[model samples]
Target: MAFLELNDIHKSYFLGKEEFPVLNGIDLQLDRGEFVSILGESGGGKSTLMNIIGGLDRKFTGQVKVDGRQLDHTKEKQLDNYRRGTIGYIYQSYNLISHLNIVENVLVSLDMTTLKGSQRKERAIALLKKVGLGDHLKKRPSQLSGGQKQRVAIARALASDPEIIIADEPTGALDSRNTAEVLKLLDQIAAEGKLVITVTHSQEVANYGTRIVHLTDGQIDGDTRLKPAYPVPQEDQSEFRARPLSAGASYKNAFKHLTFTFWRNSLIMLGTAIGLFAVLLFSGLGNGVNAFIENQINSMVNPNSVTVFKNPTGKKMSSTELQQSMQQFANDPSKLLLTDDQIDHLRDLKHVNKVEPGYQLSTYTVSYNKKNSSGSGIQTWTKAFSDNTIKTGHKPGDNEIVINKNQAIALTSAKNYKKLQGKTVQLTMQWINKKNQPIQITGKLKVVGFSDNAQALAAATNYHTMRQLIEKKNGVTKANYVSVNVTNSIYVKQVAKKIQNLKDNNKYTYGAITVGDILDTINQYVQIAAIVLSAIAGISLVVSALMIIVTMYMSVAERTKEIGILRALGERKKDIRRLFTAESILIGLFSAALALLLAYGFSSLLNHILYKIVKFNIVQISAANIISTVIIALVISFIAALLPARRASRLNPIDALSAD
Candidate 1:
């Protein structure tokens, strides 16, 4: 069998919905180590034949057999491998990656083979030297001459050591002297038991080939052999030479270059980082503030606390009527509130604990002599309540008064103030007379145990219970209801149902809700904040993605020559696509890592300050938030790079090289 075979290959295209044939009935074959040159006029489909042979375009009908493998019927995955391992291609324009050094550019094509680090590096360097680029291994393509760049392109093609080296006008860009040099190099490679095929218009370059074929209108018109051909290798010769690296190595190479490339563009990195920072910071801060509010509300009252108030009576009570109510208050404080009879009935139900009747006294300021401060709240005397203290006085007796710890502290701190431990101080009360005058009292009282009831006061309320105080001063009142604290918060619903089942009239009603409900009601504003912050964060992420698109598109434009170079040097279309995608994924991962670090740093600093003031570490971030941010970054990066990658992969080698 011939080393390579193409039988009646036909390729066509559709322009404006009309069929246009590019190649028709091309029959060609060559044994191994035969140097064959194909000469054709411009647009005569010589390059198209080369493209088909290189496996760059598969839309054709023909039988192409290379070493007994059917090239035309090959699967997509196998074709990728064939391009990576079985063929080496060189183009007329010196296709070299501008961002890569001479050696790195050559090694890029070898990434798909099985070569390891040192070996791969070595093979790439040897090929560079063979192509006369030994001293320019560290130089980028732009730093090299046109002849030197084409030689580097040839070296890159040879890195995989394929059975055939397909060159399309390899010396087209060179001067007479450099053209002779490139032709001699092709002769040498062909002499080394490798099939060298060149398509060119130069007769000088074709004369060095052992055979010459002429193509006219996509058909081979002449074939002449002048030397004995070498035998085609039966074994997989790709493995004997340096193979491309593994998939893992490809990722590593992509990451390494990506790092260098981004760092080289410092301003872009900074912009991306700033955008990511905004997204991270706002989300963290919003979640933190919401959590703090929830903690505060949860601490002050049960998340499940429910207050019941009686529907108001329209007519106002006369002073006489209000006083007569004091006569009935002597029996029990509960009667002034829920009435003792109602309390007795409520307490008999399951899940019902003691029902405490309470009333609030209006806020006030306390003063001794020349010392006054406001913001004092009071609650009705409940036996179970434990949130306040009277520093130097007992509970308010019928004829005396008790002051809060803060008010007592301020009183004694004044200049010329006496140690009023037992000294009589005037308690100026409000609304005492018919004209709402303040009552000055000199009731003497001893300082007893301090009541720890001050903290329970939200702002301040004078919550005095008994009816006698209201009757004497005209400021207090009998409460209309009692708060029944259930024994078990979880069973509050059961207790409410039991109360509902009581035979009381419709005039009596009760309700209970979970602590969760109260928190939801109080923190309803948090939802708005979360949305606002998330949107702000989301905008930044979108900006980051747009930035990525701009950057990658610029990269594709800047590296058009490089993409063409890779395509000509055995890189499949998918491989070119994957390289760009890999670069983008790396960018996203980097930004996400940065966002996480910044979020953690800010969260820690803010949490410390808040904990000192509020006595709670409420600003907590969950794992879901972190995961969500990282996933978002990755998706954005992948999406942003897609268009650029596809554009790069679809670039025609001829057009890409022709671009400035």
Candidate 2:
């Protein structure tokens, strides 16, 4: 048995129904240390035979035995291992990756070996030095001369230390002097006890080898021995060996390619960033608007209180229907009033700190020194009113009342509106008793405070003071509404739900409303607007995804030849896929970072401008939004790369190496 054997190999190409044979019934036997030259004409199957031996052309019907172990050509994984471990190819074209420098080009082959970090670099440097190109480690392929390029190719081929080196016209593109130097290098490679097989058409090239096999029309016409084979050396016992390419190597290569054309990729990144920025900006705006609205409402009313009213219909009502029900109070106020039993029940509820029975008249009037101002939303003061509501003075006490800026300026001027404070005014209100009869309640009160808050727009007097005035006017003091104060703000919602769920004979007895509920209704609209804006941003994101897809597809087309080289160097399908996918992911990450910067920068400026007018920051970007942006970017990139990367990985090495 020989070290390497080809047994009755046959390969053919079909053009429709016509079969064109390239190699027919070929049988050869050879051993290591023999530099064998298969000399033939251009179309006489010399290169095809080399491809069969190198494991790059596996579709042929043949049994390639190395050291008596036959290679199963049909198994792609097996062929990949055979090429990765035993075969090294030196192409005539010097097919070096354009983006990689000299040392890096050699390291591309060494990356599949088990050599660790610095060990691989050290070996690649040593190989480049051995080829007499030690000072040109950083130079790219285009910067090197023809002879230097061929030397780089030789270094890369020998990087993995394979058993057999296949040179297909290694000196074909070189002058006589450079050709002599390259042949001397090949002779040195054979002298090192490894099998060297060169495919050539030159008779002088064949004579330099140990044996010359003259191939004519895919058949051996002559076999001549010029010199004996070199002695086989002792097997290397080192643990170093070839393995599959790791994901980290794939990512590193991807990044190298990305930076090689950074300017072109930057456009894709900017477009994606703009789309992401829209999402982030709108999300922040929603947050800011929600906070501002809550702040405005909280400044006028207490958060730890809920209003309890008689549920005359004894059913849950939407906010719209509830507002309509309040309008019904003008015709019959008694029907909207809470009975004494309801007030006591509210006071006894859990988490209830205090319960105040209040009166709300639909309309009221205040006359001071013959100047009158009519108002609505007239309600007695309760715990529901925040202390901050009165910007000028204290809350109404005893015979005192608080008036808003509208009425104060109506009675007095805006500048002298403060003068209305501490001035006596005649307050008159309309209401109804339990008998369903209308009545008039009038009292002479002194204004103590003035405000511009929404809740204090209409004048408010203390509950006890209003009750006294109503009694004095021969009117029944009905409790139209009850303000229930919770022990803590957190308990407001829980207690309110209990009140709204309260039943008397299977019918709800009370309706509860809180500041949080009102804000929640308002926040829904805010969220809808944010979603609409985000949805529009999502349209741009779709376009971004398409952009990414087109970019990856273009990359696959541009790097098709490189893809072929990598596959010939033993890269797996998944590694090729990961290469492209990793680059796209980098694009996504950079875009996300850019979007975050844009969002924060614009938000800062917008908030600064709006804060002076509204007295609040209106754009608040949260940590959650940042994380969501990153996740969206990654998912989009991964999904976008799937098709292009798959197509790139599936390309045929023979055809790919031939691609322009």
Candidate 3:
């Protein structure tokens, strides 16, 4: 059993059922510590044989045994392990990753081992120092001369401490001095008890090896031994352990590549951030405007109370029918009027603190001395109204009225409005009777105080006085609406629901309305507006995803050779895909961060300007909005990169390495 064996090996290429033999009946045996050179002409099979021995060209028929273990090319993982741990390759073109520094290039091979963190960096530095290029560790491949680049490649090949070093035309691109230097390094590597195999067509390159094997017409023609092989030293087998490739290493590489093209990536991120910013800003604005409207409405009424109206027909009514019913009730109080029994039933309901009967007359007139106002609406005062919503007025007593400031201004001048508070005024009201006949009623009331303008343009009076005046004229004493006050604001919605479910004569006869219901309707419309604006902004994000797809495809095309290099260095197809995917996710994260920053800054400025006008912060961005933005960005970015990543992963290593 030899250290490495190739028995009766045969290889051929096929083109449309035609076969061209590259290697035939080649038998060879080699041991460690030997600098062996396979020499042949350009059309001969020297490179083909080297490829088979290096486990790169596995489609050949042969028994390839290393240290008495047969090589099974059918298993992909086994081949990957063989390439990663058993052999190292040095290409003729000095295929170095352009974005990586010299030290990083070497570390790419060592990253597959268990050596962690600082230990891997130290090993890469040591290998570079051994190759006489220690000071150039931080320099990229393009910054170095051809000789220096070749040295870096050599250092990278030796970083993993493989058993065999396979060099394919390693000195083809070097000058005489550099060639001599590389050959001397190869000699020293062989002397360190490792097999050094060189494949070349030049006699001068082959002469430096201790043994030379000649190939002609796909067969070994001759073999010559120049000196005795060095003795194999004791190997440190414990240092070589199988370790899975690190995803962190791939991400680091992707970050380096992204930063190398920072300006291009920044432009893409800016475009993406603009779309995200628009969505977040519009959503925040909608939230703030809805909140402002809710506050205004809540301040004008008791949120813990619900207003109930009688449904005269005892059935659901259409919008037009409901409007006509309300108008008829205003013109004639007998229509759709609630009785005293109904009010008492509401007061006995659960969570109901008290019930307030209220009447509104849309047709009315008043006379104060010589000046009188017509078309003035009148409302009866209740406990709920006087306790919660009245801003500056005392409860009206019998025959006393409280009018809004606007109504006071309408009747008299602003300066004389204060003096009218204690003055008496004559009130005359007219309405249609139950038989559809017209009727007139007259009464005298004194002005008590002024209420807030939010109570609408209605004159308020005591419930007893309004009822007495109505009954005296045409015998109408029913209330048009009733106010049901709940014990707490939290139970307003529940109580309102119960009131709406109340029935009269086996049909629902009442409708309830709470401040929360009004607010909910308003907020619903606001959310709809926000959604529409966000959808428009999302069109730009679609365009941004297309931009990402185009950019990733371009990156794959530009770095085709780098993809090949990674494949040759024992990276799986999934690893290649993850590299591109990781880069895209990083772009998404950066764009999301930029959008958040811009939204915060703009919201601050808008809030400052709005606070002066509305006395409230009117643009709020919530945590949910931020989280949703980030998730949207990442999902779009990942979907955009999928096609390009799969394309890069499926590339053939040999074909990619051949690409310019």
Candidate 4:
């Protein structure tokens, strides 16, 4: 059997439902260490024949054997191995990676091989030296002359030291001088005892080969052999020669290609960064909002306190009626409304603090120096809900009453005089008695302190005790609101439970809630807002991911020839896919990191702006944002790169090499 043999090779194509034959039962044979050339017209199957021999184009029928190994209809893995270990392919386009140095370009061929990095580098340098490219090792393809690039390509083809070197129009893009130099190198390669087969349209190229074959419309038209007048002696083969598994070669090729094009992948990373930034921005903002709400609620609440009140009522009664009813019910002897007995019982619970009783009264109209105003009309009335334990106000005296800032403001800014601090104010205490009489008492009370925030009164209902007011307003004894506080915040619920147990059969009934419940409610609302913001960021991320996919696909189209050259030079299909995929993954990881940093910066900027308005310290970042952003970026990148990587790996070497 010949070293490389083709027996009746046949290939066909389809064009609009018509069968077009490219190769018509062509047969050829090549011996080890022979220079053979196939010359043909542009449309002829010379390059196609070379592709079949190179293990790049599989859609053909023929008995193609390399060193007695069958090639036609071979398994994909076997074909891949053959390409990696036995054949070296060079193309007319040079196919030098624009971003890689000549030596690195050559090293790419050993990616899947068992050779380590140093070994690969050594081998690459040796091949470059052999191809007269030793000085140009660090030069990119664009930096080198046409002839120099072709030499680098030839060196890359020799990286794995394959048994056969298949050249498809290797000198097509070169000038006469470069063509002559490349042809001379081919002769030297064959003289080194490797089989050199070339497809070309130049007569001079054909003349350099020991055997010349002509193809017309895919069929062999002329076959001639030239006898050498003087044959040269064979060179010694005691140098580097070994074969590793194809899997190793695939990995090596992927690494080599990725290293060469790493810088170009930054653009994809930028896209990923944009997505990550948006996502982290919203997530961080959400966390900030939640924290702020919690702080606000906690500061206003006594951590160990529980307040008892009616579950929200649906009545829209006037403020006068509400205040009167609350005061009347709380002070009523007939209705037990959280009596002193119930307060003492709740004091026995673990971690019980004070368990102070409290009440609220609204719409108590006051007149100071002819100025008249109602208590319910005050905005800060809620601050007065706290008991005297958290405040310094004295209990209501006979013919005198005390009120919060809301009430003080009402009395101060009534119709007449503005100053009512020490002035006597006429306070009208209205009540509905057992007889349902609209009884009103006019009392003279001194103006006291002003109400601040809700946090000033943690126990509730202590602005001025209603006991004196109830006594003054005869025939009305009742109350509406009540509050309780514990010794320890951790045991606030224990005290609240004791308060609830005081219910059941008691006339004094109420609902109960701890500080934790109030803060929890605020936090829940903040969390919901965060989720909404994060979702908005996610939408932008999705768009960025799609953009990456589209960009990568365009990259694949641009680098089709590069992929073909790599495959012909012994890179596996998996390696091609990995090169593209790695490009995308690197981009994503870079973007994720960048996005996190940007988010941090953006949050600081946003917080500064908010501080000017709200006067509060706000934005904060966490490790969770980093982890989540990275994971999301990786997933988006992998998903986006899937199609482009596959398409790049599946390209037909013959067609790719032939494309302009």
Candidate 5:
């Protein structure tokens, strides 16, 4: 049997149910090492026959057998393998990828073989040397002469060492000298025990082959043998080798294309980075603001302690009901006042260091020599104030008070504020009793010092002073609230929980409020605000994704021929899809990296400005935020590329190769 057999092939074109025959009842047989040319005029089915034999046209009815195995054109994968392993096509237009260099173009075919890394590159270089374009291996197709381009095309076709060479109008565009060079190269290919088939219109081109077949209209009209075919070479079967393309090759190809369109890709990345930057910045700002607020609150109060307020109604209440009850108790303090036994019980709880009784008078008036202040509150504590920065004198003793600097200025006038310390002041306090009667208490206290600006409008003293005054006026010394100090800050929450569950009268529940609780509420609001702002920023990400989709579709349209070339080189459908998808992922990665860099720079500058004013770093970007930004970018890019990648993979190689 001949090495290749085309038996009774029939092909046609259809237009609206009308059949137009192109090739009818064509039968041919050829063996290895035979240079055969199909000579024909225009519209004589020369190109159509070449397409059928090259595995580019699979819709025809034919039996094509090569090396005793029948070709199943209906199976796309089998056709792909045949095109990649058995046939090499040299086109009239020299369909070389414009972005790739000469040697890189050859590597496109060799990449499909078992040769890896430097071996594949060496093979490509060797093939280019054979075609006499070795010195121009790094030049692009645009930079090469027409003859050089054709030589590079020949080198690429032979890169994978296929068994057959198909030249379709190979010299149609070349000058006489270059035409002779290409024809001589074809003769050399055939001499190496390979089948060489040329399709042409000129008799001079046909004469270069050993055999000539004339086709007047679809059917073969004549056949002539000029010289005997070269004898087939005897080589070890183990020498034959090929392998599938690797992922590294795909990524390399993708990187080349991306760099070729650097400016365009950079524009898309900038848009995407803007969206990610907004999200990351706002998230970091929210974190920083929360931390600052917690730090401020902790500085003012003891983080290792909780303040317990007696429940007013001796029953469970909703927050709203609790607020109303607390308001009522505030107006009439006697109803919610804690007794000695309750304070002692709180001190015995686990993790509790001690319980200190405290009194707070919200409606108080302080007067010193006709300079008076009303609506000023007074608080007495058991623990010494460590956070307070006193401007003069010291913390309050049992009979002394430390007034806020602002309040002292308001009471004594700003000019006399410094001299007011150590002076006696009269305090008058009033509240409604449990019997629904108004009560008033008055006491004289000596001012000890002025606190720093943080303490807004309150005065503080030791608990003994407030207790003695309360007993003298109301005839009852009941604690309004008790401060329960835990052994360590780490146990604050646990101790607070126990204190909140403690009952004052075995019926009323106590409420425990810690510095951490207030900070948590503030942090919750800050996070909500951040999320809302980031969501607004995320609107731009949607637009960016749409831009990526449009860009990928444009890439598919622009590289349609390149796609066909890759498919012809034995790439699977998924491989083509992966190539495009990998490009999108690279875009996402670039955008994410740019966004992170911009966010870091902006945060650093903002923190520098803020630290001067607030004495703290106010922008904190976390690792998790950076990771989330990257993952979001990748997911969005992957989703955007899906349709374009799928469309590119599904394209028909013949149609794509023919596209303008």
Candidate 6:
């Protein structure tokens, strides 16, 4: 049986209900070891017949049989397998991918083969050398002459070792010498026991083959024999076999194209990078701001200290809920006053060293010599106040108080501020009793020193001294809060959790607040502001995504022919789709890398400027932030390429291969 046979093939084109027949009832029988030229004049359907035989035009009514087995051309997968495994196509226009070098262009075919990476390159180089273009392996088609480009195309066609070779107008644009060289190569290919078919209008090219089949207006009018077919030779059965392109190869191709157009893509990367940079920068700023605030507060407060309060809700609350309850408790201090049992429970905590019951006045005032220094915050001294907070003198003892440094300086002259220590001052505040009756409390206290910090800007005294002054008056008083000192800082949270979980009458009796908790509350607001800014900056990513979409669509349009070439070379639709997506993802990754650089650069400069004033680093990028930026960039780029890649993948190979 003939190695390849076409039976009763008919194909037509339709334009608005008008039928134009291109091929009519074509019947042919050809075997390996023969160079068959389909000879015809213009519009003789020579190329059309070649397309059908090559499995590139499967829309026609055709029963194609190979090696005594009929091919199911109606099935796309079958046709793809036929093209990739059995057919090798050499085009007149030398359809070499513009972005790929000569050797890389050949690998486009070899990548479909089940060959090792090294073997694919080695075979590609061998094929290029066989075609006498070994010296031009690194050169692009643009750098090669017409003949050299065609040689590269020939090398690419033979790379995967297909059974049949189809050359369409192979020497239409070449000189006589180059045309003769190409014809001789076809003869050599046939001599290797491969079926070679060439379609041409020239009789000189026709006679160069072993058999000449004369075609007239889509019909074979005559079959002429120029010479006998070459003798069949033993072939290597273990050579690389053609298969579907793998995902890795698709990505490799995409990367090659990406680097080939890096300059144009760099602009797109820069635009996308700017958006990622903004988000990362703001996130880092939030991180730095939180760190700085926590550091300052931590430095001025003892971590081992947790302030215990009477539970207003009698239930655990998240940090956000606890903040809302602060004002409610402050306005009604009578409700927040802790009983003796609650104070004892805090002292009973396993890790607790001591518990000091205290009162935090929402409003208080100090007057010395008819001059007043008023404050909205006044808390009795506890271990929560670090020794570093006191700028001068020692902690206030007995009936002595330490006020805000700025307020102390305001009431007394700055130079004599230290002299105010040991001077008697009148402290007064309004408080609510157990019966909710408001009463005025006053005390004559001596100033011991001043406390200075962002958080500690208030008047304070020993808890017992404040309790004594309030009790000495005709008003009833209670401990509004208790400061629990833990044996170690590491156990602060564990001990605090225990205190907060303590219950009375099966209801939560107390809540714990620590310096870290307060800092966390402040950081929450900072985080929100950062997120809002990042979200605003995220708008630019949308624009960048649109840019990517536009660029990908433009890429599909530009690489239309390359897509056709790949499809003709047996690439699956999925491979084509992934090819473009891989390129977009590369764009995204490169953008992320660029964004990381930009974010770090800007953060360093901003922190440098900020540290001089605040004495703290105010912009810190974290690992999580960097990772999020990369994932976001990839997702955006992937989503942006979907439609364009789909469009590219669904294009008709016949139409795409014919594109200008």
Local error of candidate 3 at residue 454 (angstroms): 6.0
Mind sharing the TM-score for model 6? Answer: 0.95
> Each model's C-alpha lDDT?
0.66, 0.89, 0.83, 0.68, 0.84, 0.89
Evaluated against the true structure, the overall lDDT of model 1 is 0.66
Tens-place lDDT per residue, model 4, 320-430, is 333344455544324423445544665666765555554443346766667666555221123213333223344333333444554555445544322544556666655
- After the best TM-score superposition of candidate 6, give how far the Cα of residue 573 lies from its true spot, in angstroms: 1.3
State in Å the error of residue 605, model 5.
Answer: 2.3
lDDT of 2 by residue, 1-660 (tens): 788999889989989999999888789998899999999999999999998998889878867899999989888898888888888889889999999999999999999999997999999999999999999999999999999999999999999998899999998999998899999999889989889999999998888899999898887888889999988888777558999999999989999999998899999999999999999999999999999989988988899989888877878765445657777755877678777887898878889989999988778999988999988888889889888888889998999899888899999887898888888999988876547677788889999998786454577999889999888867777688899999999898899888888898998888788999889999999999999999999888899999999999999999998998888888888889999999999999989999999999999999899989998889999999999999999999889999999999999989999899
Candidate 5 residue-wise lDDT, 153-237, digit = tens: 8998898888889998999999999999999999999999889999999999999899999987789998999899888899546
Residue-by-residue lDDT tens digits, candidate 1, 1-660: 887899989988898999988888998887777899988788888888887887766778998899977875456556566777778877776666666788887778776566767877898999998887788888988899988988987887787877789898998888988888888888788777788889998777777889989888878888877666655445553554434345566567677678668675455545565666666666666666777766654554543333322222212332233334434443333333444565566666666556666554345554566665454444444433323333333444443444555555667854423354554444333323334344432122332323333554422222332355456555424454455666776876566445543444543333233344445654567767766776875776777788889988988898787676666555656767778888888888787777778778877887788888877655566677778777877788899989999999899764675678
RMSD to truth, every model = 7.8, 2.3, 4.1, 6.8, 3.2, 2.2
Q: By TM-score, highest first, what's the ranking?
A: 6, 2, 5, 3, 4, 1
Clashing pairs in 3: none
* Pick by TM-score: 3 or 4, better one: 3
| Stretches > 4 Å off in candidate 4 | 26-31, 39-44, 72-74, 175-177, 191-193, 201-204, 207-279, 309-354, 361-451, 454-464, 467-511, 527-546, 569-598, 609-613, 626-650
Model 6, stretches more than 4 Å misplaced? 312-326, 329-332, 432-437, 487-501
How well does each candidate superpose onto the true structure, as a TM-score? 0.72, 0.94, 0.86, 0.74, 0.90, 0.95
Off by over 4 Å in 3: 7-10, 14-18, 25-31, 43-70, 240-242, 311-336, 360-469, 501-510
lDDT for model 5, please. Answer: 0.84
On the 0 to 100 scale, the lDDT of residue 543 in model 2 is: 95
| Pairs of residues clashing in candidate 5 | 114-243
Identify the runs in model 5 with alpha carbons over 4 angstroms from their true place: 237-244, 311-335, 374-378, 382-394, 413-419, 431-438, 449-457, 500-508
Better model by lDDT: candidate 1 vs candidate 6? 6
